[model samples]
Target: MSFFFAALCRTLSPRKEEDVAEDYLSRDAELKVKSQTALHNSHDSVKLIKFADDTTLIGLISNNDESAYRREVDRLVSWCSGNNLELNAQKTVEMIVDFRKSTVPPPPPSVMDSPITSVESFRFLGTTITQDLKWEPTISSLIKKAQQRMYFLRQLRKAKLPAQMLVQFYTAIIESILTSSITVWFAGATVRDKQRLQRIVRSAEEVIGRSLPSLQDLVDSAFYGRANSLTCAGGKSPAEVANTACSHADALNVFRHRCNGKKTCELNSPVFEQDPCSDTFKYMETSYSCVPATHRVVCEHSMAYLNCAAGKVIKVLGADFGRRDHTTCAFRRQKSEVEKIDCTNDAPFVAEKCDGKNTCELRASQAVVGDSCSNTSLYLEYAYICTDA
Candidate 1:
């Protein structure tokens, strides 16, 4: 009799639970509904994903035609009004994702006369995404957030916490942020960006008074077939190692351009063979991922000469060695050689002198290049482009 009663109770329980779930679903549907619209004669559709009180609309705008998106925004606003739900204009934000060779600027989208702010990058669903699809911004943000939590880690250190407990705390709090979306963004992160992110982990290791494996090492350990060898030049100081690594970032940029949209690409190929740093030490290295390239140019000029900073070579594009007019060649002396002396021919000489060195200083005095004109006090005016080695 007891077993029969138990069977009856179990059978009735599901029905009661189903009724309650059905009532909640109905109430939720009435309170919040998905916003949708058709475009181009229903060829394209905009759909919204509704979760409780939050709604996110997803759609495509071809040729930068945001008209459909604007219409949907208006529709959502109208629906909210009909449902007696207040739409917060201040809280509304929009992000544009463009993956074209030539992208058109999107016009400002507005709702209820308030212009929504467009962002180059924004945080959504715990991930930072950018218009250019680079992960530097997200890594930077994660580093900053992890750094803030370092203060607590310091306190734990001062409190004489056990090494194991400290490591656990860091793993639970700080490392969690660094590793949250690593799989998604790691492939597109530059070497410099990865090093910056790893520095935080190194700091935690230092604080805990124990050596810990890096994120890359952990990844390699997890995936047996994905390990790639990294070889550093022997006898390199820590600073030089960093600089060498930075030069590899250029290769990463090229890799991204070729493999970003492709379905598959070889991890080791001759396509990524350029050496930007021209380091004396050679290493057999391979990269398993791709990321956008970053370039920097630095120039310095003085009355005596011009110099290109280390890691750069000066390529003089054009120059005027003599006085032209007051406005044209102000650097020229009052008493100059000829009215205008073309320094275009001197580019080869300048390149020969400054090409390979870390810092190249070229003297503007007559000693380096014979005086073009005796009477006029001429000044050197020049423009040059710096190219990475």
Candidate 2:
């Protein structure tokens, strides 16, 4: 293809653009393409010809009508040097040698960064990424990132009070070296382990995959009414899961302070607590909502939440929306079937009675337990990040 294109282009020019392009372009790729173009500002008589090498040449000859074909012929004659345009086969070798000898690639241009006028100090490129964001680990951005993480955790807490050990969240990694001093500052977290950190990372990945379902998954799961059940932050026991989540959150806060960043205060909110809400339920098969990834925990029955009494979800303790009736339950009731809800209400659904017909069509598989021992898929993604800094 290279030979073909070059040959084609060569036949179009007495002196191919490739031969003069480097010199005119200063060996810059952007300039190379630009220099090779026949960018005429206005219509004019121009010399356009093909060469034996199949290279094309286009050049301004004359704009005047009188000089039309004459100017083009003159340009070609000049390209031929002393030789005539109608050259016989005998002089072809001599003409080729002359053209090759005259052609040489242009040198690359010299580019320098902003000049250093002062010898004493230099203005370095700002280490701060003032532009976009990265989905992976990096050194500089910490607090901005931590707060982003905190926002996500809070959202999980709002949706799933007793979020499972593997509830997912966005993550970022910082070098431990930057935070080693900070971990020591926290007396309790001195015995950190690398393997433990890896486990935490795996947990975080599961959480993200669940929350943000891809476009294809969203279409297949939502529009098609397919059962892609995945529970993130919901688990067999809320108490055990909350404890594990807190440890990871605490480790991240420690990592930040060591980097001379803001010290995140201890959180006593239900977000970091075991038994965060008044009620508990054994999760059946949990499917995602809204998007393919937003987790929707499906309890087996409309039985009152362990935390509810008098037909109302208890309020003294934080009330979560799970474990309610299939229709007209507290959460759904607040919507009035069509009205807008100012605050989230407890939402539950009643499944058609189970007569051993296996009517429960929840896709339950990953890490299952509880009365759901027979139905497996009760699993949630864990989203997290750690920095050595």
Candidate 3:
């Protein structure tokens, strides 16, 4: 009995239910009355309640399996065997397995949960109607609705629409529709029964894959109705926007998340790397930061320590007292080439008495008068600092 209500709720409430019937079916009061009677009879006493845009399917399941949340849904079929339960094979899915498979990449929003009202419509008598009035949502029901819309969206792309338009259409629609990548596999089987529909979906997928358009680029065409200073062409609803991008809410969420990580993003030439974001793991040993000069190492405090192999700072020098020459040509040098007659006419047989800003003193050593120098260019060349000592 409970299982019957579950199916019953789906059929009775069209608001929560999405259109599953892609087929252009008939509309007439006679068929609807008959169908409604048949469906109501099968479900027994199940009361349905409605909200503004949402409908709640409230029915008690008599089956212990359902109340226990067991795996089997077949018990309902046993109860309604005599009626037309018209269960499409494509609609059903292994919920747990599917969810698990879907977690890696976020699942696309299910069509069954569509905030949109009415899908596959029907007409009973003079009134035009839609199927949302007929169904309840469970994961199973949603999958089926998704499949149907998947087919419809594909058809739009394949129409004589221009390629650019098609690209825009799929970008917005598919992004909203394709919540998970794996949904494609299910989509394939959804319309396998109809070759035409299958072709539509395949084409949509092809368009979606090749273009990879996001919903970010669109201009609102409709004016603010005839109320204000709005004189424009035909007015279209939000839905009429056709290939409008993903829902604003979802797009904003993703945008905010990426924005929060702005510092981590390697944008422009300025990059802020986290500690463990290295490749060869060699630099991970000690703290050395890469400087912009030649393959040189700089400490975290923007001080150059040692030149790097690749001319770009590879290793980050740590707090140790390491030193590096300035980034550019600091001191200049002149190259000396051996000239034949240079020393022959030179007065340098005697070491020229050195006089500069600083003077050098001769030490009592066994060598020439080169022992001690003040500023000590030549003498300091051999002088070992305490650091080196």
Candidate 4:
């Protein structure tokens, strides 16, 4: 059973200034969810999801054993009651997503002595989610909301409003609805469902007498950099605007440098050495994935060998040849030597040498990765993953 509850940089002139700034607002939700998750030590078979005031419990029941799930639910109810918070059993719902054939519906768990409602689908947050996990209900709801907003765009057009204003209106009202939580459902949406969404954009275009960015374009080029947790976690970020009118070839290098292994990052526009689209208004657009990697540490003046099992090859993610901390190569090193911890030299050479190879050796010496800080001990710290040969 599962329960559902709902919840930019500007660069200056040409000299390629690479200064990273701190971002606190973007880290709030991720940190909140993580902290809350740590507080609840439920059974391994049960998962708890909490967002704002909403709480959802998902259980992996095997062999008709739901003891863990029920125990967690009871604990949640007890927690709420102890906190002087009353749960609305009438509003609470449970939906089981079982794929096995010839199975019976699971018993409903009670909340506050009243049986919780059982729903085939429920609106969690703003997106409508069903047991089957299909996206039609969510998409259809969006289409209906967008179609209703399109009527206002038609009225604005009839008033002889400027094209720019009409476009803004459509984007603010209609487009927002059509793309709400898009990253969750768009990729899995069937071709027919995607078309239903695009039709709304097309309808708004007809009303405003101007071409708007298609749904696909909006999804593909929504935002650049790891602005939020979702964007970094392979989900589209609706907070940032899309600027497909411009493109930058060095975006990969800049982003990889600042955000390759970090959880959260921010970049200014000046990071781009040469702005590809200078004349048009521009914003960065990119997408990246978070993968599990293996880390290797090698002290300076030593060689580190990276290897993979049979039928597998190495793929380097990112590496640094200089020491960033005192603990890395602190063995038999002077305090002054290890104190220069700000050193970090790019290790692109490592990637070039080890990528796609089954086994490789890396020498952590000045000859290979130059000493960024003089008289300081350095180490080569790199991360990589193995893939099929």
- lDDT of candidate model 4 versus the reference: 0.71
The TM-score obtained by model 1 is: 0.43
C-alpha positional error of residue 238 in candidate 1 after TM-score superposition, expressed in Å? 53
- Clash count (model 3, backbone only): 29
lDDT of each: 0.55, 0.26, 0.27, 0.71
Q: Flag clash pairs in model 4.
A: 6-125, 11-270
Per-model TM values vs. the true structure = 0.43, 0.15, 0.19, 0.54
lDDT of 2 by residue, 13-129 (tens): 334445557665776545322222332212253324343332222222222232343344334334433221222222111001111334332221111211112111111121221
RMSD of each: 20.0, 27.5, 28.6, 15.3
- Please give, for residues 1-389, the per-residue lDDT of candidate 1 as tens digits: 00000000001124444655687787774433323442122225455655445556655765555566567677666666544355566666676666656755556666568777766666656777676778887888899999999999999999999999998999899988888777678866778998998899999988999887687754422111111223443565544444433335454444443333233433443444665445333333333432222212111123434446677765554333433233433444353433443321132455466545445556555555555555544545444455576
- Which portions of model 1 show Cα errors greater than 4 Å? 1-54, 64-67, 99-104, 217-389
List the candidates ranked by TM-score, beginning with the highest: 4, 1, 3, 2
User: Model 4: per-residue lDDT, tens digit, 1-389?
Assistant: 33322110111212211111122344442211112223383688877776766777777788878878888888877666544355666668887777777788777877757777777887777888887889899999889888887888888898999999998898889888988988778866879999888888887877878889888766654333333233233344443324343456556667777556443445668666676644334456655544456777788889989899999999987887776667767988899889987667887888899999999997888899776788888888788888899
Score residue 53 of candidate 2 by CA lDDT.
Answer: 30
Q: Which candidate wins on TM-score?
A: 4
